[model samples]
Target: MDQRWEDAVFLHWRIPVPAAAARMPPGVRPDVVDGSAWVGLVGFRMHRIRLGAAVPLPWLGSFPEINVRLYSREPDGTRGVVFLSLDAPRLAVVLGARAAGLPYVWSQCRAVGPGRSDPGVGYDVRRRGGRTTSAFAVRPDPTVRADDELSVELTARFGLHSRFAGRTVHVPVSHEAWTLHPATVTHVVDGLVAAAGIDVEGPPASVLYSSGVRTRIGRPRTVRGT
Candidate 1:
C-alpha cells in the first residue's frame, strides 16, 4: 500500500484582464478562453512522500487561467473561498481571475515555509511589461492530520490595489482526493459547464459512482442554450 499522505495546497490571486491576456503563452486556444474574458492566478503545492523518506516533499508551481463561474451562491459583494481540485491548473486560474474581477495576465507572489517553524519562502509577481506593480508576501499555515488524511493551510496577503481588497475569504479545499482523482475533476467541471446553461454535446445528464464511503455526483450533460 502506498502509505503516502499527500496534500495539495492552492492559493487564489487576482490580476487585471489585459495583464492576464499578456501572460498567455502566445496562440492561446479559443476554447480555453471564456467568453467573459476574466483572468486570475492559481498557486499549487504538491506534497508527497519520498520513497523510504520520513518527511513529505513539496513541489510548487502556478498557472494563469480564466474563471468560468462559481458554484456557490452568495449575497451580492459577499466574499468566500470556493474549493476546487488542482487537476486543471488553467481552469483554476480562469476561475480565480473571474472571482477577483481582474484581467488574466497578472502574476502574484508565493511563499513556502520550512517545516512547522521559521518564516517561510517568499517572492513577488513582477509584471514583465515595464509596469511597476506592488509586491506582497503570503504566510504558511500549520499542518493538520486526520487519520490517513492530512491537510495544510495558508493565507495570501495581496497589495491594496488587488481586486480582492477589503474582502478576504479562506476555504479548506482538497485536491484530487484519491478515488476522485482525474475522473472526478472532469465530472465536476463538466457539470459546472452544464449547470451554467452552456450548450455541450454528448454524455448523459447524471452519473453515479462509489467512493469508499458513499455514492457521489458525477453527471455530464449537454446544455440546451449557450
Candidate 2:
C-alpha cells in the first residue's frame, strides 16, 4: 500500500511500562525510553492510498485519522508501533483494516488549519460506535530538526506490530525521514488515550509536528509461531 500522511501532529506521554505493556498484542513488548514507555496520540490526513503502486482509490484513498499507539520491539530488537485504536472517517477503511486484524474504528474526524500560519493545525475525532473523542490545536516550529535522538526514536519506526488470526504479525513500512518540528499544544480535549487503557494523568511529555511524509507499507510477516 502507498499513502501520504499530511500535517501530522504527535502528542506523546511517558507512562509506566506496565500501563503500556498491558495493551500490547502478543509477541512484542513495550519499548522503554528513559525508563518509561511512551504512548502517542497522532492525528493526520491520509492521502492517495493506493494498492501496491496502483492508482489511488477515490474517496477511500483520503481521510482523516487519529490513532492511539505505543512503541514496541520484537525479541530481536526490531522496533515498531502497536496501535491500540485507529479512528478514521471512512467505514471502508475501518472495515478493511479490521479484517486484517488491526484495531480500526469508524469515526467522525477532521484536520483543519495550518490556518493563516503553516503550523497552526486543528484536529477533531469522534468514534462512531462509542463516545471516544479528541480535539486539539497545535503550533509547529518549522525550524526544528528531526535528527535529535528522541525525535529519531519516535518517528523512524519501520513497521507495525499487529495481532492477526491469533498470531502476531509485523508489517513493514518505509518512508523518507520525517522533517519534524517542535510543537506546542495550545488546546486539548482528549479521551482517546484513556480509551486505549493507558492513564495519562497530566500533560503530554512531548508534542511534535510534521509537514508529513509519503509512505509504502509492505506485506506482513509472522513474528510469532502461530
Candidate 3:
C-alpha cells in the first residue's frame, strides 16, 4: 500500500462586475456587465452566475448570458442546488466554497486513496508568507482517520520588505492502505480554489513537485508450515 499528497499556492483576487467584464480576455463574454457577478474561470470550466430573477426569453444562447442557479447548504449539512451556472467547474468549486464559507486562496491541500471507493478529502488555507505547504502518507499509522480534523495557521508580518516563507499545510488520512495519486490531488485542490471565488483566468502558471514511496509489505515463506 502507498499514499500521496500535494500542495500548491497561487495568487488570487476578486474584481467587480464591470471591471471584471472589461478585463475579460478576447472571445470571452460576461453574463452581466453590471452588478454582482460570481466569476470562476480556470482551465477546467468557466461559470458565470447572474444575480437576478428575470429570466431571458427563449432563443438567446449566443447572446452570452444565462440564468444563474441558486445553490445552498443547509445548517443541518444537507446540500442542494439553489441555482445553476453554465460553468461546471465554477459550479463545483466557487459556489460550493461560498456555501461552505471556506477561504479561497493563497494555498490548497488535497488527500486521496485508501482506494477508488474511498471518499477523498480536500482543504484550503489562507496564510502569510513563510508557511510550508505539505502532503504526506504513512503506513501503520492508526492515529489517522478519514475526515480527521484539518486546520490552517496564519502568521502576521511587519516590514517594508517583509516577504512570505512557504507554510506547510498538513493533510492527514485514516490509513495508508491505498496508493496516492498526485494528479488526483491537484484536481481537487484546483476545484477548492475555484470554489473560493478566485478568478483563475488565462493560462495557469503552475509549478509542480512530485514524490512517492514504495515499500514491500511481506516476504514469501521460505518453508511450508508443519
Candidate 4:
C-alpha cells in the first residue's frame, strides 16, 4: 500500500502496562518506554491512498482517519503498533481493512476547521452507530520540535500486529522519520480510545503534530508460533 498521512495530530497518555497489554494479540506484549506503557489517539488525513505503486484511487482513496493504538513488541524485539479501533468514512476501506483483520470501523470523519489559521488542525469522528465519537483540535508550534523519547516512541512505529484467520500477523510499514512539531491541545472531547476498552482522563500527556509523510505498507507475515 502507498499513502500520504497528512495533517497528523498525535495525542498520547501513559497507561499501566497491563492496560496496554490487555488487548494485544498472541506473542505480543505492550512495548514499555520511559518505565510505562502508553496509548495514543492519532487523527490524520490519509491522502492519495493507492495499492502498491499504482495511482491513487479516485474518491475512495482520500479520507480522514482516527486510530486508538498501543505499542507492542514480540519477545524477539519486533516492534509494532496494535490498533484497537480505526474510524474512517469510506465504507470500502473499512470493509477491506476489516477483512484483512484490522479493526477498522466505518464512520463519518472530517476536519473541524483545517483551512483557518486560528485553532490549527483537527478531526471529528463519529462512528456508524452514533455511539462513539471524537472531536478535537490543536495548535502546532512550528518554532519548537518534539524530539523527546516519548514522542519518538509513539510516532515511529514501522509495522502493526493484527489477528487474521487463526493466527497473528505482522504487517510492515515503512516511512521516513516524522517531522514532529510541538503542539498544544487547544480543545478536545474524545471517546474513541475509551470505546476500545481503555480509560484516559484529563488532557493528553504528549501532543505532537506533523505536516505528513508518504508511506509504504508491506506484506503481512504470520508471527511463526502464534
Who wins the lDDT comparison?
4
lDDT of 4 by residue, 90-197 (tens): 888889989988899999999765565574899998887889888998999888889988789889999999999989999999999999998999889988888899
Which candidate's TM-score is highest? Answer: 4
lDDT of each: 0.26, 0.87, 0.25, 0.90
* Residue lDDT tens for model 2, 136-162: 879887776656778778878989999
Worst 10 residues of 1 by lDDT: 151-160
What stretches of model 4 exceed 4 Å from their correct place? none
Error of 3 at 105 (Å): 12
Off by over 4 Å in 1: 1-42, 45-123, 130-134, 143-174, 177-224
Per-residue lDDT tens digits of candidate 3, residues 90-121? 22444544443322233332333334454332
Model 3: ten consecutive residues of lowest lDDT: 153-162
Q: What TM-score number comes out for model 3?
A: 0.19
Write model 1 residue lDDT over 1-226, tens digit each, in one string.
Answer: 0122222222222223443333322222111222222221223232232323343333322332212222221233222222221123333444654565443443332333323564332223333352423222233333422222111111211111112333323222222333311111121112222222333444322111111111121211211111
Candidates 1 and 4: which is better by lDDT? 4
Model 3 ranges with Cα > 4 A deviation: 1-15, 33-35, 40-108, 111-122, 125-226
Could you tell which candidate, 2 or 4, scores higher by lDDT? Answer: 4
| Model 2 clash tally, residue pairs | 0
Estimate TM-scores for all models. Answer: 0.25, 0.95, 0.19, 0.96
Q: Every model's Cα RMSD, please?
A: 18.0, 1.5, 23.4, 1.2
Ordering by TM-score? 4, 2, 1, 3
Model 2 local distance difference test score? 0.87
